[model samples]
Target: MDTQFFLSMDPPTVTYQEKRAGVRNGKPFFYEDGDLKAARQKLKAHLSKHRPKKPYRGGVRLVVKWCFPRGKHRDGEYRITKPDTDNLQKLLKDCMTAVGFWTDDALVASEIVEKFWAERPGIFVRIEEL
Candidate 1:
């Protein structure tokens, strides 16, 4: 696997699923939740700062590992929580697209996402051109 680029962001206060939305004027809209918005903004800023010189235009593979702060569970333990892995991917991919990590999130032909308990919580992402 030839990795095009990699990025790591400190754990965000709000997880992807925590982003709330509502209908206004008959149109769905994300709520102006300060914490959620701030978390997404922080992710975008980090991605923009570390984005590849040129966004990947071809088929790409994305690997995302989310490390959550350890609670009663031990480190490396898989988290069985409210936010599903797919839900988490939604926000992350959106942020990557916003920061121009790739021409489009659709360019990602393969994806692997996982969550685990850890002492140092963070998000680790790797992109490989396929």
Candidate 2:
């Protein structure tokens, strides 16, 4: 089975971060950054409205196309800015998991992610069972 959707919102440039730990009551507590949490929540809420009826179980291929507004950059140009491609995928995949797009993100055996400058900004996602 294949699933595809487009989120018509300017994608966040923030990314998931490594766990941060602190000692509280002599106990180590791990936490995520507040910006990351907020970004994830926003993504989850956007995706929940269009989540598939059932999660994909088998190995899957995921493609994410990120379109950023053409500001100083020319249209169709690749975005070579902060929040690298891999970092962007981290948050997106986690959000996909939260919305039940698949049983686990590990099921995503292959991924194609790209970012480009565009007249309009949004995210296009495609998932196919493999």
Candidate 3:
């Protein structure tokens, strides 16, 4: 099975890597920063609307295209700035897991992630059974 969709909204730049660390009673703990928390919540809310009827149990290929609002960069140009791809993908996969797109994100045996500047910002996702 293959599922593809485009989410129309400004993609958040804050990523999961922005976690904060603190010591509590001589124990270290990690927590998401306020910006990261907000970003995750926003993504979860949007992603929940697109959950598949059944979670993918088998291996799957996941593709994500993150389109950001164009600033000085030309539309369709690759974004080579802050918020590295891995960090962005981590947060997105977490939200996908929460929304039950699949039993677990580990089912994603292949992934292709990209970022670009665009006049209409959004997230484009394609999932295919492998």
Candidate 4:
């Protein structure tokens, strides 16, 4: 499949870039500590959900995608060239920063169903949420 179509399919909710690197979007983002900070913030909200009668005790998994404009960031790698493909590692890590906030966009991120990924790969940002 084409790269742009793949990345654009999701209409990324979280707007971010590598900590000190710029790419297709012509801007840099917080990637170095993005996962750590994102995970902490997400867990905070996850735990809050438990305060109420939330016996299920299930935390959601969020996926972060940073496909370069006109390119693809899949799996964990950025496909900058034509017919691009990668491991989406950065994307997943970035999503870690948005663990708890995933559901928050249910109303705004309309393509949530097609765009969301279930697991956090490469990085150990699992939110064994309480």
Per-model TM-score on C-alpha atoms: 0.81, 0.90, 0.97, 0.19
What are the per-model numbers of colliding residue pairs? 0, 0, 0, 10
Q: Give the TM-score of candidate 1.
A: 0.81
Top candidate (TM-score): 3
Using TM-score, rank the candidates from best to worst. Answer: 3, 2, 1, 4
lDDT of each: 0.78, 0.88, 0.93, 0.32
Q: Please state the error at residue 74 of candidate 2 in Å.
A: 1.6
lDDT of predicted model 2: 0.88
Query: Candidate 2 deviates by what RMSD?
Result: 1.6
lDDT: which candidate is best?
3
Better of 1 and 2 by TM-score: 2
Quote model 3's TM-score. 0.97
Residue 77 in model 1: shift from native, Å? Answer: 1.0
Q: What is the C-alpha RMSD of each candidate to the true structure, in Å?
A: 2.7, 1.6, 0.8, 14.3
Which structure is stronger by TM-score: 2 or 4? 2
Error of 4 at 59 (Å): 11
